[model samples]
Target: MDAADAMAYLFSPQGRVDPYPAYERLRAHGPVVEIAPGLYVATGYAAIDEVLRDPRYEVTHEELTQHPVAGWAESPAVASLTGSMLRANPPDHGRMRQLVAGAFTPRRVAAMRDVVTAQATALVAEMARRGRDGATLDVMDEFAYPLPIGVICALLGVPEADREAFRGWTVDFAAVLEPEISDAELAVADRGAVALRDYFRDLVEARRRAPADDLTTALVQAHDAEAGRLTGDELLANLVILLAAGFETTTNLLGNGLVVLLRHPRHAAALRDDPALAGEYVEELLRIDSPVQVTSRKATVPVTPGGVPVPAGGRVLLLLGAGNRDPERFAEPSRFDPTRPHNQPLSFGGGPHYCLGAALARLEAQVAFPLLLRELPGLALAGEPRHRTRLTLRGYATLPVTVDADQHHRVVVPVPAGERGTPTGAGSGTP
Candidate 1:
């Protein structure tokens, strides 16, 4: 396919299913290619990296509003989205980010390791119970989806019962991020935006009344030494961003990682033998099939990403999925190699707009992968996996897998005298 055809395919259902072949075509064209009259796409590693880190390339509310969907101008989704740090620039972005940064500290994220492990283990055990008779378990719905939601909701002080409701709300709100959503989808997203805002308003009010050690309380009560506190809208909007971002990406990560491991049983066994390799394995999984496929930035002034001029105010969709697979940056980019050296995939982006929850997301994946593999040794795909109909977030909506309690009984060493409990579902693998 020609560069134009390849770029066009990205918006088509076929391309959404698997865009790597199209990415190769675009890369073959050049570092960057003008996909449309005013829009461009960056496919090369160095080119995408430069664009992500470039100060001249930025996200702005004004740019996001341009050529928006049919009813987006007056939609509540637009109102909430426009106030978020995701679309802001300069002073506003810097100030809000600083407030959030204080709460999402490394120490705070590291504290969730035990929480993640416990949640994953419980889910795997539940799967074993349901699948004991050789029934297929929908791992995505039962395991992958709930882990991050439980973790993030707990961290944000959101009640356990409300987490499921938020899942539906997030699914609706996600349509706002798409490029060509319909009027009907916009209406659904509008209602979702309103519902989310109302829910957060009450939560923020409660936090104000009596603050706690959770991130929500920190954000609600945060005060900059000079910049003052976040406005009502700012606080509410960012809370929504945190809630949505906190879980959505990590959910995809867990699902995608499991799919890869199931495809390569040796790697799964390696991780089962020694869970320490999870950190490295997670990184490679992210590089090969990133949860977030693309992000856009606008040119503030006339500039060039790959020696091709982009007029001021023009938009460039940075193909992060394509960039991660650029042969120039990674040898045998398509191959999944866990032990790869100096692997710096732009999965979380870079520069000022980098994802604030990156560390937390990484932590969850690192903790969850090991638990799933160790707890379910015979975990294998039971049916055809179904990917979500989403262009940006690539993940399975349903992953059917069967687990064998007996298969998980493989032991490398003699079980300790007192440590050997009945291998009902926990199995004898203690690694």
Candidate 2:
């Protein structure tokens, strides 16, 4: 397909399912190519890196979205999301980000290691139990989604029983996040956003009434700090953002990583034997097939990315997935090599707005993958994998997998007595 056709197809429902070939074609046009009148796409790694590190580029704020749906400004969800640190620029972004960073501390993440491992162990056990009779199981529903959800809920002080309710609400809320949205999808997003906003508001009030030792309580304390560091809308919006992001991306990571493992059983065995290798494996896994594929930015003034001019207010869709696979950046980019040296993917973005939950997300995958392979020795894809129909957040909706206790791959090795135990899963983020 030509550049225009490629861009159009990338966002189409069918093309969105697998946009790798289109990405390769876009890069052939140049690092940054104008796909539409005022919209450009950055496919090359260097181009994306430069645009990300440049202060001239800013996140596409609500004003730049140009959503023609009536009453978009009145949307509580949109208002909350846009007001949050994620999309805000400069002073406001810095302020809210500081407060959030203070609450979401490194110590908090360190403490979750035990919680994550326990959760992963239990979930893997449940998967083994359910599929012991040779029954097919949706790993996305049973394993991938639950691990991160359980972890984030625990971190936020949410009740365990209330975990399942978020599945539909988050799914509905994610509609507005797509590259394009229909009026019907907008309506669904609005309703879901309203529900989420109210839920967080109620939770905040409860935390205020009786403080607890969780991220929510920590944020509540931060919000109550002197000088009014975080506004009420900022608090609610970030709460929704945190909850939504905490599990969604990790769910994708787990699902995507599992597919990679099942496809290449040797790597799974390597990780199972020496769990420490998970860090390297996860990095490669993300580089080859990232969880979050696209993010947008608008030029505040005339600027150029990869020597391509972008007028003021011009929008650029950064194809992160494409950048990860750029042949210029990676030798035989299509090949998945876990032992690659000096490997770093633009999966989480760069500069001031880098994903705060990045380290935590890596830790979760690192810990979860080893145990998953060891525990479910005969796990295999039972049916065709079904992907979530969106380019922004690329992942599987239903990964049909079966645990074959009898048929074992040569790669499934027995772990040492001292090295064996239930594993873990936890964390959240954008990429």
Candidate 3:
């Protein structure tokens, strides 16, 4: 297939489940190819990496606002969302990122290890309990989805009771990110944004009245009275972005990681034998199947990537997932080797816009995977998995798994006064 044909197939719903073949075709074309009149696509590792790190490339909301697309970047709702750091350039992006960087320090993420472990363990236990009567478990519902949502909710001081509504809002908001979205989808996104604004408005008011020790409160306090670092709309847009990006991306990571492991039984067995192998497994999973597949940047000046020239004011789509599996950069890129060396994946894009939640996502996966192996040794897919109807943020809508309860004993660990406990006793079980 040519570049344009490949782009069409890659963004189509049918390709959501597996876009590798299309990605391979795109990469084979060249380092960069114009998919359309003003759009360029980069699939090679070097090309994608260069664009991600290049100072000439910018991610501005103005590009979206100016686009003629019906569903994406065309109204007041889109304008309100431009306040977020993801849509801002240099100084604004730098300042917003720095303000939140302190909260995601290595020490802070390390300290959250116990919390992640406990949350994953609890979810597994609950899944086991619910499945005790021979019921099949939906991995997405039982484990992958809830864990990150709970974690982000706790971090943001959002109540657990509000999680369901928040999840709906997240779904609608994320739908707007896909390429070639429909007007119906945009209307849903608009409604979601309005609802979220109202929700955060009340949340901020409450925090103002009774300051709490959470990220939301910190963000509120960070806004100096005279300087006005963030306005009410900006805070709401950011909170919405955080809630959606934080939960949805990590949820997909865990789901995709597990799918990869199951397909490569050897890797899964290795992880079972050595729980410490989780760090490597997580990294390899990120390389093989990243949650965020595509990221876009607008060229401020004419630039050449992979020897292909991109004109100024043009849009460049970086296929991060494709770059992660480029044969030039990785030996046997298609193979899912847990122990791959020099595995610097572009899963988390490079430069200033790199994912702020990378550390937390890694911690969640590191804790979740081992606990899953321990809880259900014979955990296997019950049926074919279904992918979410999203091209940008790829993930499973449902993953049915059957747990062989007879092969493993259920272990209950206590939640300490201030912390949570880890699972104990590692042994072999029938696969």
Candidate 4:
């Protein structure tokens, strides 16, 4: 198929489960190819990296709002949430990022390792208990999805009772991140945005009156200190941004990571043997199947990426997952090698807008994966997995697995063998 036709196929639902072949076709056409008017797609490592790091390429919400795309930029709710740092460029992005950076410091995230591990352990234990009678387990529901959401909710001071309500918001907000959308989907996204804003508005007020030792409280303090810096609306929007960005993205990572490991039994076996390799495994997973597949930037000046000229005001979509598998940068790029050195994938992105919660996400994975492998020895896909409909934040809608009795026996207590027990530099954010 031609590049355009291939890209169309890449976005088709039939291709959602496996887009690698389509990506290869697009990459072969050129590192940078114009997908449509004012839109360019970059696939190769060099081009994707350059675009990500280029200052002239901006991520302004206004750009998205002005785009002809339906639902995403057009929806009022989507526009409000995207106005956060994720879509801001330069100074504004820098300001919002700095405000939240202290909580996501390497020291802070490192300190969270224990809490993350404990959560994963409990979830896996529950799964084992529930599946004891040969009952199939939905990994996404039982483990992968809830782990990150629960952690993020705890960090944000969201009550467990209210989690179910917020989970719907998470799904709604995530729909806006896609390249394509429908009117019905936009309405759902709008409802999600409104529900989330109302929920956080009350929560923020409660935190203001009775401040807690949580990120929400910190954000409140930050807003008060820098009065004109962040409006009340901005504060709510930022919180929604954090919830949507933090929860859904990490869910994909965990789900995709497990899928990759299951497909590569040797790597899964190695992880089961040496838990310390969890860090390496997380990096490999990020490269092999990045959760955040595509990020867009608007060019401020005419520039050339991989010999393709992009005019000022042009939109550039960086295919991060495709770049992670570029053979020119990674030897045998398609292979899943946990031990691969210098495996710097564009999964967490780069440059000024690099993901602020990356450290926390990595910490979550480092703690979650090893504990999962140790807890569920015979864990295997229960059935054919189903991918989510969204193309941008590529992930599975459901991942069902079956765990055996041996896996059930592994989670009898809080302390697993060889586990340090103590939270390592708990919440220190050292990395």
Model 2 is weakest, by summed lDDT over 10 consecutive residues, at 422-431
- lDDT scores of the candidates, listed in order: 0.79, 0.80, 0.78, 0.79
- Tens-place lDDT per residue, model 4, 232-275, is 77788889989888888899999999877766556677778788
Candidate 3 overall Cα lDDT vs. reference? 0.78
lDDT of 1 by residue, 33-136 (tens): 88777788898888888888899988844433224567667888877877888878888899889878865689977877888888888887898788887776
Top-lDDT structure, candidate number: 2
Which structure is stronger by lDDT: 1 or 3? 1
TM-score per prediction, in order, is 0.90, 0.91, 0.91, 0.90
Per-residue lDDT over 1-431 for candidate 2, one digit per residue giving the tens place of the 0 to 100 score: 68988887777788788888789789889999997778898999999988888999898754323346666677665776697887889988898788667545688777778888999999999999998877889999988899999988887888888889887888788777776666777788888888888888899999999999888887888888755788788888988888888888888889987886776656677787888888888998898789888888889999989899999989998999999988888876776668767789998889888887877788789879998889988788786788888787789988887787674332332322322223222211110
Query: Candidate 3 on 1-431: residue-level lDDT in tens?
Result: 78878877876777766788889889888878887777888889999999999999999454332235565545534754577887789888887777677777889989999888888888998987877665678899888889999999888899889887877777777766665566777788788777777888798888999999888888888774536677666677777777878898999999988876665545577787788988978998899888988888999999998888888988888888889988899876776666678788998889888989999999999888878877877777666777887777888999877676563342222221211122112321112
- In angstroms, give how far residue 240 of model 1 lies from its true place: 0.8
User: Candidate 4: how many backbone clashes?
Assistant: 13
Who is ahead in TM-score, 1 or 3?
3
- For candidate 1, give the lDDT: 0.79
Instruction: Tell me the spans in candidate 4 whose CA falls farther than 4 Å from its real position.
Output: 62-74, 405-431
- Candidate 2 residue 201 Cα shift, in angstroms, is 0.8
